[model samples]
Target: MAKQSTLDKNILHFLGPKHWLTWLGMGIAYALSFLPWFIQKFLGKALGNLHRALSPNRRHICDVNLHMCYPEMTIKERQSLTKAHFESMGIGVFEMFATWFQDRSKTISKVSFHNEDVVEKALSKGKGCIIIGAHFSSIDLCGTHMARYIDVHPIYKLQRNPVMNWVMERQRRKIFSKTIERRNVREVIKSLKQNKAVWYAVDQDYGRKNSVFAPFYGHECATISHISRLAKSTQAAILLYDYGRTEKGYFLSLTELEDYPTGDEVQDATKINQLIEQQIEPKKAQYFWSHRRFKTQAIEGTPSPYSK
Candidate 1:
């Protein structure tokens, strides 16, 4: 954990003002979202053109993810999907700014919910539940919508930009007072004990020691152990929540993972990984393919070209 913290600190230092660039980009994106529907649509289309012109390294990451998850897809099919993926990414960028900048009531009104009873049931149990989500199409909006039903304490990895981080923290704190840092395990556990729902994006690559290798899209990747440990320790019900984009905007789907493994740590973590993959399979384009998901590979062999 100490090593991972050091690594994150170093990476943050290296990235430096790149975080400000993201905020600047987001500022433009947020303004674009409020444009006329036709204008927003046109901007989305233009993003596809820019994505197509990406250099080899950037394009390779997208290509590798597509090939790995959809091995049966022909090159043409994969390329088409990749383009669509970029278009969605562009839209998502704009959506994030819209979500953060817009009024909470307006943003929440744009999203609908299904199977909210699943959450109600978990809360009724008197033990706070862990809501496991991923980098799906409208993940940011999911947290906003969820705030209407329950107090969601989301753990976020702080960004490098002091100014932007201040803005984001203020925005999120409007809905969740318990927005703890990812490294603060103690605070997370305390929130769970208080029966407060906690949200986590467990799909990211947490280096070797902190994570165990688990199968995701037929590849063994490092999976975070915190979810399993938290669930077992606090006796918290685990729920899978994903946001799917629709013509109207976004909708949240909540499912109870009653079948989550509990005995063996390795098997338990793998079960969670599989559940995430299953949820994402139907909405492959919604998943964040641009992320380095397979950064840490299993031993005994090299990672496939598609890995990460």
Candidate 2:
């Protein structure tokens, strides 16, 4: 918790004319928060279409990612998937509002879970559980909702904008037992030692240091080895936490990775990537294809596939 004086300073700083755009954006978010669900979704669709028109570079990134991951798909099919992905990302924006502003009880009530006992059984081991999250668009809501069921400690990267970071941190504090900074390994390990559920997103390209080249969607990806290291150090159980939005509601799934960490970091990373791949296979569009997941190359001096 920050001191009242610091918070006051931030509020005063954010009130300056230079931050008018931030204020306007936040105001729109607040206004959309009260709108009907269907109307909000309609606006999200419009936002998606606008993004597709204005963000050609991001669209190109998504196109390249989808093409590489799904080489068997036709060009038309990949484009369709890319468009749907932007829509999902747009919906995710509204979902961020629902998550940070909507009633916590209502949010938790809507999540229907399968194999929830898997989480309980893993926690029963008394070693804590590492909930491995991917870049699924539904994660913003699902991460917060999971806290209602378990004592969650989510690892987050700090936003570059100070005000934005403060706002998000304030909201996340309401759900997570403790929000761990991504760089603070000691705190993360300490949380695990206390038998707390620590959530981490493993599907990212973090370069060579502390990462290994592993197969993701049959392509070599620079996968982080920290999760495997954490599991090994704490003797904690690793569980894949995934969710999808259906016509009914959000379907959250928890599956324990059997015989994980195998004492081989690279092999464990590959297994983690495989698990994430399986989860997104059924709903490819929901996965975040806009990110440069294959940014890092396995071989030195090999040009990035996404580079122009």
Top model number, lDDT: 2
Candidate 2 to truth, TM: 0.94
Q: What's the C-alpha lDDT at position 247 in model 2?
A: 73
lDDT of 2 by residue, 1-308 (tens): 33221222456766778778887887778778878778877787788778988999889889989888889999999988988898988888888888777766765656887887887798888899899969888788877777777788988877766566657777888778688888889988888788888889889888888699889988999999888878888999988888887775688778888888898988988888888888888888889899999999999789988889
Cα RMSD for candidates in order:
4.6, 2.9
* Residue lDDT tens for model 1, 114-212: 898898899888889899888875677667778887788998887664545655666787767668788898988898888888989889987888888
lDDT of each: 0.75, 0.82
Query: Any idea what lDDT model 2 has?
Result: 0.82
Which parts of model 2 are misplaced by more than 4 Å? Answer: 1-10
